[model samples]
Target: MTTKNLPIYQIDAFSDVLFAGNPAAVVPLSTWLPDDVLQKIAMENNLSETAFFVPVTAGNADFHIRWFTPTVEVPLCGHATLASAYVIFNQLGFEGDIVRLQSKSGILTARRYLGAIVLDFPKQPIVPETIADDVIAALGGDTPVETFGVASRDTDLVAVYDDATIVRSMTPDMSLLAKLADRGVIVTAPGDKTGLDMISRYFVPAIGINEDPVTGYMHCVVAPYWADKLGQDDVVGYQASARGGVVACKVVGDRVHLTGEAVLYLKGEITVSA
Candidate 1:
């Protein structure tokens, strides 16, 4: 097996501190790596997801990027996207403040806005639906006072709780959560403790994730739901996961804009075996 030095960086997105938000590994590569190699790197990093960026053109503005989890590849991921942007802008010595990423989903742009990185993402809207028994079981038997279903680029389950604390304090059965197929669950409520407008937690055990530390993809659905519920297009959301994260969100027509900060944790090199 041959080896090459691969640059990697660990970044905490949606948080200003070292360990608060989701930690993702960003690997900037010169060319596309083999699928097995990418998966193995993600598994070795053992983070929620790792991002790989390949330069589309030398010193050009855009690059092709892909994200992979230890188990599978994801279409879209917010924290890792943010982490990738942080690396391109701060570490790679790119001249421009804004960078464009061409992903499996589509083109995404990130820029520094209002002292934070604002990401413009496609909006996922929710329609009312009945809750499945398994969903209720996974939620620890606390029947949602109201349930709304949303299918955007991804499937989302939005369950409203009485308050934020209950959403935060929930202990779900991961075994039952594993039964859910290809859908992400969100338990959310109006915030009483935090200054934020609402708080929520995300679970995606079906895709081999028990609990996402900070979910930006879930926010795509959450922002629009609460925007209508709260009668305001702009909102502040707090993900109550153990690591926790904060997102400043706004609903703009059929799109949602999420803004937050990120901190780079580690920078190193990897030798990919060939």
Candidate 2:
């Protein structure tokens, strides 16, 4: 039996310290592999997300990146993308401060900002909508002051609470979240803490994550929404998960720039049968 050794790096994204943010596995592939193999690798890692990237000679893009959870391949993942950019800058000897990756969500770019990585993502449009009774019940039965439907991959429901405490104290029903079919739930509120503009928590059981410690994609949706609601373009958001993290967001036109720091946690090799 022949085997191949692949380089893998585990990184904690959206936090400068270890074990404080979302951990994502990043595998640098020389070429594209089978989709099933990628899924299997992600499943083996068992993290919220695993990122795979291959160098490309395409226009204005350094690589093509893809993200997968334990169960399925997701269209967009902010933490994993930030982790991949960290690898490119720190491990791969990339010279430029800006790294552009082409993904299913369109061309995403990561740049250095004050010793942190800033991600450029499209602002997910969220519109006020009626939420189902069961979904509300799944959110601990405390009705949200507002419910909005998200127009983005992975995230579907956005529930706005009047207080940050309610967003932080939610004990959601994972079984109900799993029924959302690849969609995730987001709960957010105005920040009561100093230095924070908003707070949020993400539940995405449908895509294999019951609770994401720090979700950048969720901030992309919430930051813009809060910007419009609060009449500010720049906002600081904190994810009140057990492994809490902070995201600095700036909304410009149709784009949202997310800034956060990542730390490398583990560097190892995975042996896969060829």
Candidate 3:
């Protein structure tokens, strides 16, 4: 068994202030560990997502990234990716304006934009779908104005309500939701609050996450929808979880620009033998 003390960091993503955004754990490694060990670390951290990345020598990307939820490795995770970029830029002293993450979802890049980090992620293609009765029942019996299926690394369902107020007031039955989908369920609506174009709440009980405070990857799917609905390519969104956050979105062709801020929360080391 290999025993090592690995440096780790917890970061609050998609929020300028502490305690308002999603908190993700970041582990930077010189080499990749066994997949089971990585999953154990993520499970131990007990956060929504834990990101693992290693510096690469032969690729155009400076680093290769992976994301793990408690139960499985996810194809894409936005907040953790942002947290990883923050670590590379601030902690590792990365000199470049952009850090490209070679991930399972492909090359996801993060760059500085007006002092905030903007993540360039591919937009998920959305298709209109009818919500099942059980799915509607899972969401507190409030039938959404529209429902769509978004396909990417994971298949997710987006339920659009009439306004943000409805989104904020939701208290869905997570147990019932778990039976409906094997992925995420994003409930969203046009933003009712000032300086916000949309608001959303994410529930992913199927993947062991009940509610995500701020989901940047979700906007990659919903941003284009809102852009077309609002008749603008640039928009702002807020995730109305108990710990809220803001995400800046710009739809450009097949890709979506997801911009947000991340703040350092805690830095430490984990001693493990694998």
Candidate 4:
């Protein structure tokens, strides 16, 4: 078999500092490759998400994008989308300020906003759910202030807390949570510190991520929820995982503007054969 050298980059999204935020692998391609190869590269990179993009010729968007986790292909991902936009604007030497991507979730736009890169994503409809016992038990016995179901997934649920400390100190049973109906349990609370309105942590061990450092996609649901609670459209969210990250958000009708900083971590080449 022949090998093709592909340029790849690993970027830490939603943080200005290195080693913070979530790291995603970005692979820009001129043509589409086999799905198996794309999945293989994601597994090889071993990150929570690897983003692949091919420039689109049609009108609605600038490029076609896809996201893959170590185990499955997620419908939408925020950090990886941010990473992809970073590549397009800074590394690829594009002069434009915005990059629109057509994704499985729909058309998502990433632009430079107030010195931070921003991603415009569809807001998920949040509906109150009957909190389950296992959901509370997964968080080590701290019952959330409330819980809701997100339109993003049939099994995705959002749990709100009263304070940030509860979110930071949570040590959920990843194994148990994985088996629970909520495939992605988003635990969030009001930010305790200055310059932050909210804080959150994401656990989706069933899809192979136990705790996502800074979840960009989850914020689509979170931003709207907080905007309603805070009675404001602009808000700041800090994901207090081991590797912390800050995402600035603005809730627009049916959309959320997700903004954050990212630092380039590694640029390397990967060899693949079809």
Task: Tell me the RMSD of model 4 versus the true structure.
Answer: 1.3
lDDT of each: 0.85, 0.91, 0.90, 0.89
| TM-score top scorer | 3
Clashing pairs in 2: none
Would you give me the overall lDDT of model 4?
0.89
**Model 3, 124: alpha-carbon shift in Å?**
0.9
Task: List ranges where model 2 is wrong by over 4 Å.
Answer: 180-182
TM-score comparison, 2 vs 3, better candidate: 3
> lDDT per residue, candidate 4, 1-274, as tens digits?
5678888999999988898899999999989789988988898888999999999998899999999998888899999999989888889997888888998998998888776798889998878896689768877788787889886687888889897888999999899888875478888999899999998998898888898888998888888888999999999988899998888899989899888988899998888997
Model 1 lDDT tens row, 1-274? 6788989999999999998999999999888878999999998998888999888774433898899888889888999999998898889998876888888767787887766788877787777877788878778888788887776534567888876767988999887777763667888988766558888888888766788899788888788878888899998999999999989998999888899899978998888785
A best-first ranking of the candidates according to their lDDT comes to: 2, 3, 4, 1
Candidate 1 vs candidate 3, TM-score winner: 3
TM-score of each: 0.93, 0.97, 0.97, 0.96
What lDDT does candidate 3 reach at residue 273?
Answer: 94
**Could you tell me how far off, in angstroms, the CA of residue 23 lies in candidate 1 after the best superposition?**
0.5
lDDT of 4 at 65: 98
* Consecutive 10-residue window with the lowest summed lDDT within model 4: 176-185
Model 1 lDDT at residue 51: 94
Per-residue alpha-carbon lDDT of model 2 for 1-274, expressed as tens digits? 4677999999999999998899999999998778898999999999999999999886989999999999999888999999999999999999999999999999999998889999999888888788788888888898889988886652488899998988888998899768843478889999998999999999888878899999888888999989998899999999999999999999999999999999999999999874
